[model samples]
Target: MGETVLYVCTTCRRDGDDPEGPRAGARLFDALRVRAEGAVDLRVEPVECLSVCKRPCTVAVAAADRWTYVYGDMDPAVSAEIILAGLAAYAATPDGIVPWRERPTEFKTGVIARIPPFPAPRPFPAGTPEAAE
Candidate 1:
């Protein structure tokens, strides 16, 4: 399997936070980076925005030929370890579909979206009637 990337939204910030201070997402990214050091299967990246402004501290996990997941409402001070644990589970799976029971509590509850793999499989085979039209 290929490396899985965890994209952290660096610009995300909670309401009422000091605008001049570091953003929650950036802090989360730093935390994850520290914990993910030397990890061979996962790469942590920072993105400017995830477009979920209402839910600060957002992240996305993705890999080729696997499902992509976005999660929101993360607590920057404490979510890094949980996120890493979830990433480990995701990396161990063949198709990035971690069993619900095995996923971290935060991942199970904070998921904002789950997208199918890029270049998703066709719903019907090329020679089938469904594909004829």
Candidate 2:
């Protein structure tokens, strides 16, 4: 399986947070980075924004040929472990689809979207009539 990337939105700040202070997303990224140290198959990245402005501390997990997941409403102080657990479950799967019961509670409830893989699979075999049409 390809490496899984965890993208953290660094510009997200919770409501009422000081404008000049460190963003909650940045803190969450830092926490995840620290926790993920020595991990080989997972990479943590910080992005400027994920376009989920209303939900501070947003994050996404993706891998080649696998579904991508966006999760929001994370709390920097407590969400790292939960995110890491979910990431582990995701990496264990061939198509990035973790079983609903195995997913962390936050992941089950905080999911913003689940995007299909790029170059989506064809509905019919290449030599079939459907493919010819």
Candidate 3:
């Protein structure tokens, strides 16, 4: 798996209600990428539809097959921090549980769906995952 793992909803707000669907998700992802450097395996892909339009612009982090976290309603301001925390959790464990309380509040319960990995657009970081830029 890449250094940072990210699951992006391609058509989150397909309906009329989801204005901030993929577009907002894209911005958040771009910012996260800039902050993540390369050590964190951060892969952003648009999924067909996560089926949770209410929570448009969903984001997830999957690693070790044991834990996959899903979070939505992502405001760009917090996205970078969220991604970093998720990466830390992913890196902290052989599984992907960074303690119960320590886990991201949105993903504390876990993600809604767990899809397959992408082909590989952006490669994983070679060394340590840097802090957000």
Candidate 2 global TM-score: 0.87
Q: Show where candidate 3 strays beyond 4 Å.
A: 1-4, 13-22, 109-133
All models: lDDT? 0.93, 0.93, 0.62
Model 2 clashing residue pairs (backbone): none
TM-score per model over all chains = 0.87, 0.87, 0.61
Give the runs in model 2 whose Cα sits over 4 Å from its true position.
120-133
lDDT of 3: 0.62
Candidate 1, clashing residue pairs?
A: none
- Residues 18-98 of candidate 3 have per-residue lDDT tens digits of 464446555566677677665545565546655666776677777645556677776655657776776776776765556
Candidate 2: tens digits of C-alpha lDDT, residues 1-133: 7799999999999986778788899999999999999998899999999999987789999999999999999999999999998998999999999999999989988899999989967589899989888
